[model samples]
Target: MWSGDELDLDAYLARIGRPGGSGAAGELRPDLRTLYAVHRAHTAAITFESLDVLLGRPVALDVKSIEDKLVHGRRGGYCYEQNSLLAAALERIGFEVSGRGARNRTRGDSLLAVTHAVLVVTVEGEPWLCDAGFGYQGPREPVPLGRPGAEVQQGEWTYRVRKEEDGILVLCLLRGGVWRDLYAFSPQRYHPVDYVLLNHYSSTHPGSSFIGRVVVHLPGDGVRRALVGRELTLLHPDGLAERRVVGPDELLAVLDREFALRLPERDAAELVRMYPAGD
Candidate 1:
C-alpha cells in the first residue's frame, strides 16, 4: 500500500521546510494534517514541465526517483507521481487513501488519457474526498464526502462534487454557482497498469495538446502557456492576457516578464527553434 514509504520523509520535509514528524500539540486532526502534509509535499516537490517528453523518457513511477527529482533535481511530476506519493504518505500515517479514476472532459480525449485520481479519507468518522495532485488549479481544502454537491475551497478555485447515475462520480468547480467541468470519476479504483497506459498517451500521441505547447500552471494565479507558432496566453483572476510571438525570445520574455520564471538564454533559443511559427 505504501509505494513511497521507501521515500525519505525527512528529506521530503527538509526540502519543503515543514516539520516532518515534528513535535506539536493541539486540536490538529491527524487526517487533516495528513492532507496538509500531502499538499505541501506535492507543491514543494513536483513541478509542471515537458522535460520528460523532450528527453524521450517515459514517466517513471518509483519513489526513490520521484524523491530524487523532488528533493534534488527541481522537477515536478504528473498526477500519479504526486498522488501515489500522497497515498504512500497517508498509508504511513495510518490514514486510508484509495486510488480513484477520473476522466478529462475534452471531447474525444481518450478515457485512458482522461483517467485521473483522487483519495478518500475518513476524518473524525466522516469520509472526505481529497486530491492534491491537480497542480496550479487545485483545491485548497479537502471536500467532505458522504454528500452530493459538496464544495471545497482551495484559494481561488472553488470545487464541488456530484455523484450521478450508474455510480459515476463527477467532481467540478463552481464559477458563479454553476458547475463547470473539471473532471468526472468512478470509484472503480485503478492500479499501476491503469496509470501506465494513461501516462503513455498524455506524454505522446500527436493529438494530445500536452505535447503541442509549454503549459506552466501556477495554480490560483492562473495558467501560463504557449502553443507552437499560435499563441502565448496567461490567465488572471480578473481577466486574460495573450499575444503572438515571432519566436523564442518573445516567449521567454513572456515567461519571465509575466510568470517571473527565468529561462536560460540557451533554453530560450532551443524552445524557439522547436516551435517557430510565421516569420
Candidate 2:
C-alpha cells in the first residue's frame, strides 16, 4: 500500500490547483470524473525532472518526503517521486491505486530495465492508467486500461494503449501521423519497496541516464518541452519539434520561466557547476 494516511490531502489538492469543495459537498468521489480531473491537474501543475539524481541526492519515495519536496517545496521530480506522490493522493481520495514498473521504449529497440514507476487507479471497477510522470510525451489524463488500441485525445495530444502479443500493454502516442511507443508494462504489480530499489540505481548508478546530466520536462497543453543536458526541445501537437541549446547562464531562467521550477539557491548553484558545457 502507498501510505495514503500519511499524506496531507488538502495540501496536495491545493498544490495541484484543484479547488477544495468542488466535488459535491466538499468530498472527492472515487469516480471517473475525479480521476480525470486529478490526473490532469497533477500532470499540468507538477513538472518532470531528475535534478536530485544529478545533484547526488537521494530520491525518497515516502509520501511525506515526496509531499515536502514536490507539493510543498514546489520542485519537480522524476517518475518515482511524481507517481508515488500522485498514488498517495489518489489513494487518500478513496481510489483503488496500485503501482506498476514500466520499460522505456522511446530510447530505442534495445531491451531496457523496468525502472519507471506508474499507477493504476480503479474507478467503479474499471482500471485506468494514471501516470503523472514519463516526461512531456506522456499522457496528460488517465488512459483507459480496459479498452486497448482506442484513441484518447487530451487537448492537442493523442494517445492510445496497445496490448502486445506477450500480454504487455504499450502506451503509444500519435506524433506526426505515426504511432510511437512511449513505454510498456506487464500486468505484474509493484510496491513502494520496489520503487525504492529502482530509485537507488537511477539516482546512483553511473549507467543511469539521469546521473550525469540535467533533464526536465513540462508537458503543457499545447506545447510540450523537454530539456536534456544543454539541448531544449519543444514538441508541438502537429508533430513538429523545435530544438535549441540552452546555455548554462540561461538554464535556471529557462527552468523557471518555461517549467515553473525554481530550485533552492544552493542546489541551483550546484546544478550550474555540474552542468555539461561541451557536447
Candidate 3:
C-alpha cells in the first residue's frame, strides 16, 4: 500500500468522512468499509470524462502525471486516469484494490476484450466490485459478487450483480424491468498498461465520442453537461433542465454557480472554444 503524509491522507479521508479511514465509528470495520465509502464519495465528487480532451491535454496514465492534472492542477479526467488515481488513493488508505479491465455496457456491448479499467476489491473474504470512473450508471457501493439477493438503488438508478462462468463478475442495471448491460469483468488483476490501448482509442480516434465534444459530467441525484456549446442539459431524478452558456465568462459563471468549481483562465478560453458559441 502507498503510505503518505497528512495532507493527502486528510484530503482523501475527509472525502470519505472517515478520518484516518475509521475508528470503529461506522457501520463496519475501516478496511472494506473505507474502500466502499471512498469509492462512493469519489464518484459522487469527481466525474469521469475527457474534459482534458476539450482542454487540449495529453492525458497520461502515470499517477504523478494524472495527479499533476487532477489533484494539483484542478482539472478532471476520463476513466483510465480518474480510476487510476482513485485506486492509488485507495491503496494509500490501506485497502487492497486491484485494477480490472472492463467495457462500456450501454448501447450494444463492445466486442473488444476488457479494455477499460475497473476494480475488484477483496474485502472480508469476498470480492467486491468498486468503480469510480464511470460518469453515469455507476456503483455507489461495493457490490458482492454472486450475491443475488444484494442490490442497491440511489437516486433514479439501481444496480444488480451476479457471477457467471469462470468467476467473471457481471453487473447490470435494473431498467424498465429489463437487465441493462452496464459492464462485466473478472477478478483477475490489472496493470496500468492494460488501459493504454483504451486511452489511445478514446483520445485519438475520430469515431470515439470523447473527441467530439466538451463534456462536463457532475453526477449526483442530478447530472449536467454542455456538449460543445450546442446545448446545456441537466438530468435530475425528478426532471431535466437545459440552457446554453454562450461565452467564456458566462460559462465560468455557470460553472461557479452550478458546480461550485472554478476554472482557470486558460482553461476557460479553451472551454469556450471546445464548445464554441452557437448563434
Candidate 4:
C-alpha cells in the first residue's frame, strides 16, 4: 500500500494551484469538498499532454519521477502519469485511494486496451471516482459510484455513470444531443505496476495515438482548449466547437501561450518537423 507521507502534500497541492489544501484544521482528511477542489485545480493547472512520448523520451510512472515531472518540471503527461500523481497526492492526504484501469470505448471496440488510469477513493465507506487525467472530457469533480445512473454537471458538460452487466461500470459524456461512451471498467483495484505495460505500449508503440501526434489539452472557465497536431479547437460549454489550423511556425507559440508549456528547443523543433502545416 502506498502512503501519503512519501509525497510532499503541501508542495503537490500548491503545484496543482491548490495552495490551501484539505481540512481547515491543517490535517488532510478524506472528504468530498477537498477531493473536488484538488481535482478542479489539477485539471485547470496541469495540462494533459503527450509531448515527451512524442519526443521519444521514456515516460516514467514512479511516484518520485512523476512528481518531479508534473510538479517541479511543470510538465504535463498522459493518463498514466497524471492519474498516478493524483492518486499519490490523495493517498498521502489520508484518502484510501486505489488505482483502476479502464478501456477507452469512445472510438470503438477495436481499441480494447486498459490504457486509462483512474482513482477509486473510499471516504466514509462510500466510493467516489476521481480522474484528473482524462484530457478535458472527464468529470470536473469526484463523482459518487452507485447503481442505476448518476449524472454530474461540471460547468457546461454533463457526465453520466451507470452500472452495466457483468459488474462493469460505464462512464459516458453527454455531447451532440447524445450520450457517448467514454470508457468502461470493472471494479478491480489496480496498482502502479498494472499500468507499466500499458504505458510502455501507449508511449512507444507505432500504432499508439500519443506517439505520432502532438496532443495538448487544458480545461478553462467556460471552454476547453485543445491543440492536436496542427489543429486548434476550442470547445464551448454548450457543446459547440470552433477550430482553426495553426501554422507550423506558430505551433510552439500556441503551446507556450495557450497550453503554458515551455518545451525545450529540441522538442519544439522536433514537433515542427513532425507536424508541419503544409499550407
Highest-scoring model, lDDT? 2
Model 4 stretches with alpha carbons more than 4 Å out: 20-25, 109-111
Task: Give the 10-residue window scoring lowest on summed lDDT in candidate 1.
Answer: 20-29
Q: Residues 62-102, candidate 4, lDDT per residue (tens digit)?
A: 88888888988888988898888888888876788998889
Clashing pairs in 1: 46-76, 47-76, 136-219, 140-154
Model 3: per-residue lDDT, tens digit, 1-279? Answer: 222222254444454445544453233334865766677777666655576765556778876676666666656667787777777776655567677877666768456545567877677677677777666556666777647546777666667776678876668876556667778786677777767777888788776767767665565654534334444556443334555545554776766665445668887777767665555
lDDT of 4: 0.82
Candidate 3 off by > 4 Å: 1-7, 14-30, 109-113, 164-167, 222-231, 236-250
As for candidate 2, its clashing pairs are: none
TM-score of 4: 0.92
Question: How accurate locally, in lDDT, is each candidate?
Answer: 0.59, 0.90, 0.64, 0.82
After superposing all C-alphas onto the true structure, candidate 4 shows an RMSD in angstroms of 2.2
Off by over 4 Å in 2: 20-26
lDDT string, candidate 2, 70-165, tens digits = 999999999999999989888888899999999999987989999899998888888899999899998899999999988999999999999997
Better of 1 and 2 by lDDT: 2
Clash number for each model: 4, 0, 0, 1
Candidate 3 weakest ten by summed lDDT:
1-10
